[model samples]
Target chain A: MTARPFHRSQAEMLPERAAPVTTAGVVGWLRANLFSSWANTAFTLIALYLLWLIVPAIADWAYFNADTAGDDRFACKSSGACWAWVDQRIGQFLYGFYAPDQTWRVDLAVVLLIPALAPLLFEGVPFARQLRWFSLAYPVVATFLLVGGIGLEGIPTDKFGGFMLNLTVGLAGIVLSLPIGILLALGRRSRLPIIRILCVGFIEIVRGVPLITLLFVSNIILPIFLPPDVTVDSLIRVIVMVTAFASAYMAEVIRGGLQAIPRGQYEAAQALGLRYWQSMVLIILPQALKISIPGIVNTFIGLFKDTTLVIIIGLFDILGIGNAMVSNPDWLGLATEAYVFIAFFFFIACFSMSRYSIHLEKRLDTERRD
Target chain B: MARNASARRPGSPGWQRLWSDERTRGLIYQLLVILGVALFVAFIVSNTIANLQRAGLASGFGFLFDQAFFDINQRLIDYTSTSTFGRALVVGLLNTVLVSAMGIVAATAIGFVAGVLRLSPNFLLSRLVGAYVEITRNVPVLLQIIFWWVVLSGLPKVRDSLALGDAVFLNNRGVRLPAPLFESGFEWVLAAALAGVVATVFVARWSRRRQNESGERFPVFWSGLALIVGLPALVYWIAGSPVAWDIPKPTRFNFRGGFNVTPELVALWIALSTYTGAFISEIVRAGILSVSKGQTEAAGALGLRPGQTMWLVVIPQAMRVIIPPLTSQYLNLTKNSSLAIAIGYQDLVSIGGTILNQSGQALEVVGIWMVVYLSLSLLTSMFMNWYNRRIALVER
Candidate 1:
């Protein structure tokens, strides 16, 4: 037998076998995900067909034949989207009634925000320790840029009413409401009878009513409760109402996160001799906040969308601007294009935030698993 | 020795110390918060009064009794330009309720069908449903409403309106369908029809209990349907079929005599239902998916058919998950019904807006809106909570 093996035939000298592709590999993935069954195959085909129909039409209307370079409606007659309306009103849409020359200030404010926001969003980045101070500084810087105080000609709040105004309302509400919301959440869970009841009542009442009603009340009823000599700007009233509405929702979301945390964690903090506030700030909040990030982002998206209701109160957010455009004689019957454009703008922002929330959720899940 | 004495002083009463300790500072904090709230409220009231005085506007519900000279395009109750502002508001509220109710029914039906289709074993159907959901949901509802209004406006002129076999007419004005006119003794028939509903509910409960105890299935659905539909028809027949159908006829510029759903109402309804249905569909799909596959497998192993297993085991459980979200969506749809203003549907918000402009009683009008909407929301939530508890799992 050994002699026969030593006489080794070519048949015995085979090459090493290759590995088969996994279900997760490219070709196998396509088969599994897109064509695993007859039903899936049919679904893929139909989806492809529907997409083919829509993609070209959207492209043709939005880009290929769009009047991107036009100054006015007269320049856009290509049987496609007349984006000229957007181009012409872009400034007004951005800064509403803000003086034309003062748009640069708003732009500058946005530029300042990016650097401040970037480090805050990136976990474990340098200056993570400085984030609290940075948060405090942002409002001051943003206020100066927007309100034009201290030798700058003030742009009245009433004049701030468009896409930029929407952003301002949303961001202001988010920033202002968050700390209050956390406190409210804690208060609702507190042993203090009066505080818990008040917090619970506030949250329930606000959450039960629609935001539009709150805005309506702020614009209409809030003034009646004040003294006769005082005056509040419409923009300020809207901001306050939005902040209250958002805080209620945020409180509930944070409360959910708080409830989800293991009781042992709180016990451990108490065992370590941390005071209530200290334990919350150091031990509880970080984990609770991480858990509630998605909820907070969802609230922001809702706030952003709801800012459009300002139009009912006579403020010109993006939706209001679009509504304004439709009545122009030159843009008559062009409602479709204007609505489509605004809808796309809203969709892009909301979708991005939702996707980011999903990513955060996945990351949190991984961390929990580890 | 001094430290030991101080520590032992807690024996005097730890609870009393906790209650009285200045470090806790409960009274001061509570007083501060109350004071802040009161001060803020005082400021707001003063500002409002000043603004109202400056604007030469009076604040009250007095304007509600004033004659509303405006003519609403649609009204559930009889109203003309001579109606009081209060009456106009009532009409508007009814319209809002009407549209919202119709929208909820249509949306739930469409949502359930689409949601199940999205999970269909049939490939094309599922993809189509998925695409519908994604496209509809991703777009802002305001845009969809506007789009529908525009498209409806683009239809052929009223003179050359799109006619469905000379019976139904679609025009810029509205879609006209045949209206039923009740003749003499129709009230008795209506009473009998209502009686049928009461009977059906009783029978359904009894049959359900019977089935539960005996494990014998009853055709409760068909029986309920027959009682509701067939019994009503029988009553109508016994009352000499008192109702007559009035078909709409095209006039020079509009259709006449039949019930017409205005373009504004149609557009609002379609937009709201379709947009809301997309979200509801997702909720439904998620609810179904939440039911563990093991339950289905167990049912199958017990020799139950797929359909029977899904209905008997899965859906009852899935419904508990679905109803809560469904309630939220319903509330959302009701709130979004306010969007009717954008398209000129005379909903509560629109009418309130009109009242605001006409009377400059923005404060009062806004207050009424808050109360109405908040009450509506509270009522819905209470009802849903009760229903949820009734269906909730009773874990042993």
Candidate 2:
């Protein structure tokens, strides 16, 4: 067969021209996105009206007319928000009935967390490989920092309340649950009948009941169960309950990740003559855990939010403190301001964690990325 | 070289071979685990017995039959302060079920609307829905409930109560809606409604078969709707309309005549629905996204309408992803009903807490809570599992 002639390439190109006003500019964007059709135009108007109605009022209430200088109950008498009340009582809500002297311990606990956790979370951080070990010691250090025993004066668990207690329980729960979750996940997958059943039973039962019921059990029934001589701190008991609950959810998530791993990866470990634990630690867990990081963080978000449920158990978590602040004799009828502040606090925590988790998920997307 | 086939093996294997043999190792590990767990359990049991003995607290569920001696403000069942603890618990459980069931319906409706809007072709609608979801999702649900409570309580007094055509009344006390008071022939009307539902199913099946075999179109949805509505109304008319309206009236102190729904229930219901809806929208969005774009294109190429493409192709695949997580959301809503305790809503846990304090049967009360909650969880999951199986893909 005869060959076809080759096409020649142009050395240069004509200057680029702007697109027509109907299709390329701001007007075009509005046309294409907001007012493309009758339905779209109607929707745009409805959305705009809703925004117009709500946005200014909320902004006005939150900032402009908000009373920021006074501390009296009627600071909000003019129908605006009472930021003044929040300003006066911020410390009380943040720390609850915590000892004023030992408040620095709470600050130190928070400050120490960022540095201890940074290396493990981000790339190119100093001592990244070695910092994971610090997570183990961080909780111990924090416990002493809050309760104050070994080298410092005792503050007691009763003093641990508000956002301080929430952080303590939330952080400790996440850290403690991870390793326990891994073992339970493995046990559920094991061929051994008893271990599998035990792991399954624990996960199912823990997940079935609400955390409030568990908190009640921990606050009341746990003491009845334990020996009279051994006295566990209330905060410690709450932490254990919270940790056990989180571990069940974590196990389910990690199991999903494990199920996603290829059979060949496991069989290869078996081929290499590695023991079950060694193979899981080296081959299976590393892969499984990497995939599960996002899910684990999601569980952390839920767990942290659920910590506010401790309010029902009479623990002054952030929600509890907020509730307490509103009902204060001095700041009565400031439920709006109190709730708004606590809502923002929780929102910031949950939103940031979720965003970071999404970012990490994108970065760790080895298999899915094209 | 290996152990002789004819030789009898030792009953108890040594540690050296236990490592070499997988089955032996598994068995040994399981045995050790059982022993450890048993010993720890025994220790806890002994400790609990000793502690209970010293504390003078007996741990048995015998108090269930004893009088509750507590009045629940909002109850479905006939419960008095002198009612049995079991009856009080039943009232609590009934309240839990009512709220959770209603919340599920409301949340699902809100969720589906938001989910659909989130993927709207109109950018403004999508963005608005997205913002709504993000704001609702980020904040703690408890705070939302509290906020709603504050807002609802801020409503005007009973004399100045908001009225909707004199059929409903809203005030600080609660919302009062006109309730249907049925007379004698209501049972016949109900029977007619049941027949309508049965006939609609048969009609749907017949329409599907007719369309498949003869390529003829049928107004199945319209007919089904008409039948369901018309049949009950027809029967009611024939029986001289055996239902009377008990309209809510704004009395001096409170609304009277119609059923009153407490503000706590309203606040809890709205908050839970909105909060869970945000989550459900995300789940639905993900489910829809999981079905590839190629699916729609293929359906379009087959000459199916967009609606048909959705119902026949995309939704079927999306449902596989949606159902499992939807079940979890349902379970979450059910569990969250316990949050009613915060606002002094008489849920099981709250009532149980009262029983525990009054009777000093903390252990037994806690056990009751566990059993009831666990049973609920099992039932919900079992039902979901069955439904999931029914709708699951048949690869073969």
Candidate 3:
């Protein structure tokens, strides 16, 4: 038996296996995910064909045939899209009745927002370390850009009704509602019966209603409850309604995050001799917030999309501007093109947010998995 | 000495002492919040009063009973311009309910089919469904509605309307189809139909019980269908066929006297269903994907056919994941139906907006909107919660 074992060789003893190139490369992926069977092969071909049909058509309509810049409809005749409709009314779409020459103020505000928002969204940015100052300065800077004080030409709020208005409403709603939502979530989970009941009641009642109804209340019924001297701007009314609506939803999301935190974390915080607020702020909130980033971003996307509804109230958001484009005598027949343009704008914003959410979800999942 | 030392150790309050303490800090915080809200409310109330006074207008809900001079183009109930504002509002509400109910049913059907198709073993079908979802969901529903309206309106005018033989007509006015008109004994036929429904339910239950006891499958689908549909028709025929068909004919200016859906309603319905179906499809795809491959393989190993495996094993579990998000899509559709206002569909919001402008009673009108919508949202949530509980996993 010992003499027979001496004839063993590496090639003969080991079973033959496919090479790495054959087993794990591009061809393998195609075989596994695409052409796994005859049916799959057919499906892949059909999918490719459909893509070929749609992708090129979309490209042709959006870029190849689209009119990029013009003041009137004649320039866009026979072209796929009259983007000139957007360009001609661009100032009106951006600032509504805001004094045309003073548009720079709004432009400046938009520029400032990038820096303020970048620190908050991107974790690796060093600017985030100065978030306290950034947050404090944001409101003042935004006010200067929008309302025009401190030597800038004053663009009144009534004139501020368009895409910029929609963004402002949505952004303000998110910023104001988030802190309120967090507090409401905390209170709802609190041990104190009174606080818990109050928070729960407010959240439930607000959540029960639609934002339009809330806007109606703010626009109509609210004035009845107020004093004669107090005149609220229409924009402010919308903001208030949006904030209330968003806060209810945000509270629910935050509550879910809070509930997901382990009891051990709470116990650890307590053992460290931290008070309730201190423990929550220091230990619990950061983790809960990270976990809920996807939900928060989703809410932002929803709110942003909903801002288009302002057109119903007679404010000129992007949708309103698009609608207005169709009624122009010269562009009467180009309603399709105008709507397509508006849809593309909305789709870009929403798709980006959704994609970022997926990316964040992956990153967070990896961290947790580790 | 030992007891005194233990009780009075430094400034640490004993549990008993803490329990006896007044909750001043908590009370103050709560009071502050309440005061802030109250002041804000008061400010709004006062401003409204002053503005109404300044405009030389009065504020009250009594205006709801005043004559509404505007006539609605399409109404669910009988309404005239002579009708009171309150009655007109009711008509608008009914129309809203009708459109939303129809939209929900259509959206669910399309969404479910598209969603399941997105997970198809066939790559083409899945990608097609995926593209449909991505394109539709990314665009604003408002834009979609407007686009549909424009497309519908762009169809040839009534003179050159597209005709389906002589029975159906399509034009800017709307699509017209033959409507059924009951002649005689329609009530008896309706009663028979109701009876058929009851019979079908009982038969279904009995068949299930029998199948469980005897390990034999019954032809429940065919039997149920025969009872529910065939039986009713049979009863109607025996009652001397008490229904006549009214086919729409193209007249000089427009098609006359059939079941015509207005272009506005068509556009709204199409937009709502297509837009919402996209989201629903995504939820459906995610739900199917969430199910582990092991389950499918095990079912296969047990010799279950693909259809049976999907229906009996995969779908029931998948529904637990699908139904919750599906509920949100339904809510979204309902809310988005308000976009009909943009096209003058006279939905609840549109009517409410008109009333607000007319009476200068902004506060009252807004309150009504809030109350109505809030109830709607609550009702939706309640239904969804019941559904969720029914399909929810039962764990010990």
Task: Identify the candidate with maximal TM-score.
Answer: 2
> Each candidate: what lDDT?
0.83, 0.86, 0.81
Ten-residue region with minimum lDDT total, candidate 2 chain B: B1-10
Q: List the candidate numbers ranked by DockQ, top first.
A: 2, 3, 1
lDDT of 2 by residue, A219-315 (tens): 8877777888777878888889999999999999999999999999999999999988899999999899989987898789888888888887788
lDDT of candidate 1 over B186-207, digit per residue (tens): 9988887798899989998898
Worst 10 residues of 2 chain A by lDDT: A71-80
Docking class of 1: acceptable
Instruction: Score every model by TM-score.
Output: 0.86, 0.94, 0.88
How far residue B290's Cα lies from its native spot in candidate 1, in Å, is 2.3
True A-B contacts kept by model 2: 0.82
Residue B168's lDDT within candidate 2 is: 84
lDDT string, candidate 3, A287-344, tens digits = 8988888778777777777788777667788778767768888677778777776677
Interface RMSD of the candidates, in order? 3.6, 1.2, 3.0
Off by over 4 Å in 2: A1-15, A127-136, A366-370, B5-14, B55-58, B211-217
* Candidate 3 to truth, TM: 0.88
After superposition, candidate 3 runs with Cα above 4 Å error: A1-71, A74-79, A84-87, A95-97, A126-136, B1-28, B31-64, B185-189, B211-216, B233-242, B359-363
- The better candidate by lDDT, 1 or 3, is 1
TM-score between candidate 3 chain A and the true chain A: 0.88
Clashing pairs in 2: none
